[model samples]
Target: MKRISAVIVNWNDKETLARCIRSLQQQTHGDIEIIVSDNASSDGSQAMVKEQFHETFLIENPDNLGFGTAVNRGFERASGDYLIFLNNDLEFAPDSFAILVDALESVPGIGAVIPKILYSQKQNAINSLGVNIHCTGIAYPRMLDEPDCDDLAPEEVACGGIFMMRREVYEELGGFDEDLFLYHEDHDLSWRIRLAGWRLLTNPRAVFHHRYHFNKGKMKYYHSEKNRLHLLLKYLELKSLVLLAPPLLLVELAQWAHSLMHGWFFLKLKSYGDLLDLLPRILVKRRRLQSRRAVADREIARLFSSDLQISGVQSLALDFFLNPLLKAYWLWIRRYL
Candidate 1:
């Protein structure tokens, strides 16, 4: 029998951490090993897990290493045929992990499985169905904040917050890019795994509740934009990059204007500057990715959208003007690639 390992990376969120652990304890899958990778929380999250969840394997770090690093640390200690990475702020339905495990086990070439995630505060609202990549190299969670429905199907990439992967595949792919630090780490991993000929799946029958918030600030924008650019730098094939460069520049200009309006202009600049500093390492990683690529650029391009569809981010003016132009440009470039 294939054993399951659940890894939860936590920080200062004690209440949510305990709640998440309790939900994991309720999983229908029997004797699953749970590992808590606590990132030096000041709120006693480590002690809470130790006292209340004695069965859990705990690794309390001395200092806060970012999300990707902590997750990597947890995976290093895991001993299961299938591994799950869960957020401390999530609560899984009793059968969620069982369903996910079944899906991956039954499917050939599936690298990971993500559960349908709905907002805990508002049951009708979705936190993520799966991720959708854009032509300009941005990735957004599909159906976010949309009314939850049972009609959605499997997608190209799993939701980062709630997902499971085959242990061997995860190790072979080198797991999450710790260089990403936090944001867009999933996309980087997903893209690489897909390139290496593995599919990411979604199991609608498996569901979880996420305590999500819009919570945006300059630092968030900085990491998101910075890591997004890093994803493009590290994975995009040469042909795709050349094809998408013009539109990417246009998008960058729009982003600069938006950031200026929101007093994040300096942060945006800092992201660009950071990318420049990180170029050498990015190029080395890109070479390795390109050399191992199994999927062609054309196939990957088919999965990318030319226009942003998520609400609040899309404007009537952008849809009316920018979106059309981007779509037309993508149509042109994608054909030749």
Candidate 2:
């Protein structure tokens, strides 16, 4: 029986956090320890954890640090053979951990695995299956909004962060990149794990319900685009980066057009400016990861899709023109990668 350390990152989600922790306790797998990583919640979440969940480990952050940072704090204190990083707004099934532990051990090459995430608001819809990778540095859940199927089996993915992994893989990858602060840290770390010759998968047998929302506003665009570039620098070798330069630039132009239409043009510019400023540090990390990685760029290129689709956002040019052009370009450039 492998012991699993579950780390739940919370910020002002006091009620949901308590429900999530209760769900973890009710798991059929009894060898799991829970850690609550509260990001300075003002809603009395820390106090509730300390008073009610006395057995659970609590890391009360001083301020509202981002998701990755909170999870890292929990990871530092976790003491189990396997680790599960999660959000506060989730509820696990009775045997979720047991099923996930079996899945992780079932494959020798799998570094991490995510469960079939179902939307709490929807009766029978799936929130995420396997996260898909795009050529234009985008990552999205492939089976989003699909009806749940009982026979759905496990599948490989570009990356999965609401995930469970062997403790050794956690030590090797050193968890999520704190520099990303909020978004795309999963993609950044996922690429590193893949480059290190480890695979990520989704086990549909284990189910977790999430309070998934579709928010296309706020700092989403800024953090997502900025961190997407951050990972691209750290993983792609020089030759691959140069070859990918054309499509990358074209994506930037299309991004600008979309931002302007959405009234977030200035925010997009700010993301670019931050990327420019962070270039020096990004390159340093890039060199370190590139030196130690076991896989080549070409191997990973095959995992990237050519389409750039965002749910709810529609554009005539994007669907008919940019998608096809990117698809063709990726087909040609990947051979040289």
Candidate 3:
């Protein structure tokens, strides 16, 4: 039996942590170990886990270290053949871990395998089947709102946050990039895994329910914009970057304008400004990432689909502006390209 370590990162989510752990305890797979990394939550999250789940390996950080760093800490302590980085707000089905373990073990070259994630609030709705990226390096969960629970075959990517992977691969790729702080680290790792010639997969038979958002605010948007650009600079070659620039610029401009219209001007400015502020760091990291590149541009481009490319910009425009502007922008992209 292969030993698996499930690493769950927690912030101030005291309310959801118990349920998450309960679901883990119910896993039929007995060879699993639970590692909880707490980010110095003031809300007694650490105490609750310590008092209740004695089997869980708890790593307490003195300060609120970001998600990427916390998970990396967990990786250092994980002693399993397989490592699973899961969110604190997610509840796994009884066989979720077993199925993921089976998938990774069954496939020879697969570096990682993710299960179908459903919404905890809307049980029928899907959270992520598989993650897809665009030429611009924007990544999103495929089939975000889709209801179908069909089984999906193994496919390739670089890294996924809620996925299982061989411990060797995690060490070889150097684990998640702590610089990411919170968002887009998964994409960065996944991209690196693919470039290193390892396959990342999704197993539909395994399932987990995610709370999705126990907290809501502009912080998410800020981290999102900051991280998206970070990954783009870190992964894409100059040629692909040049090709993707126009669409990305257009999308950013539309987002800025929409933010102003919605009286979120400061939030919009902050998002772009965060990117600018970290420009030096991003460039330095990009050079470092490029040095480790194994896969070529042709291989990376094959991972993206045409529909995925258009949909990202389309969704952004629709979310910020009205539906009419989205249609117009979509039409413009179609005509110009």
The candidate scoring highest on lDDT is: 2
Model 2 alpha-carbon drift over 4 Å, by segment:
none
User: Considering summed lDDT, which 10 consecutive residues are worst modelled in model 1?
Assistant: 154-163
Query: Which model scores highest in TM-score?
Result: 2
lDDT of 1: 0.82
The number of residue pairs in model 1 that clash at the backbone is 0
**Local lDDT at 156 for model 3:** 64
TM per candidate = 0.95, 0.96, 0.87
For residue 151, give model 1's deviation from the true position in Å: 4.3
lDDT of 1 at 240: 76
* Candidate 3 local lDDT, 1-337, one digit each (tens): 9999988999998878888889999999988889999998999999998899999989999887888899999989999999988888899889989999898888888888888889988958988877777554556787787885565565565446577889998999888887678778788888888877788888888998988863335566567767887887777788766656666776677657655665566876786777787888878877876887788767766666333332324464455444444334434443222
Query: Which of candidates 1 and 3 reaches a greater lDDT?
Result: 1
Clashing pairs in 3: 158-190, 159-190
Better of 1 and 3 by TM-score: 1
lDDT of 3: 0.77
> Cα lDDT for residue 177, model 1?
85
lDDT over C-alpha atoms for residue 50 of model 3: 83
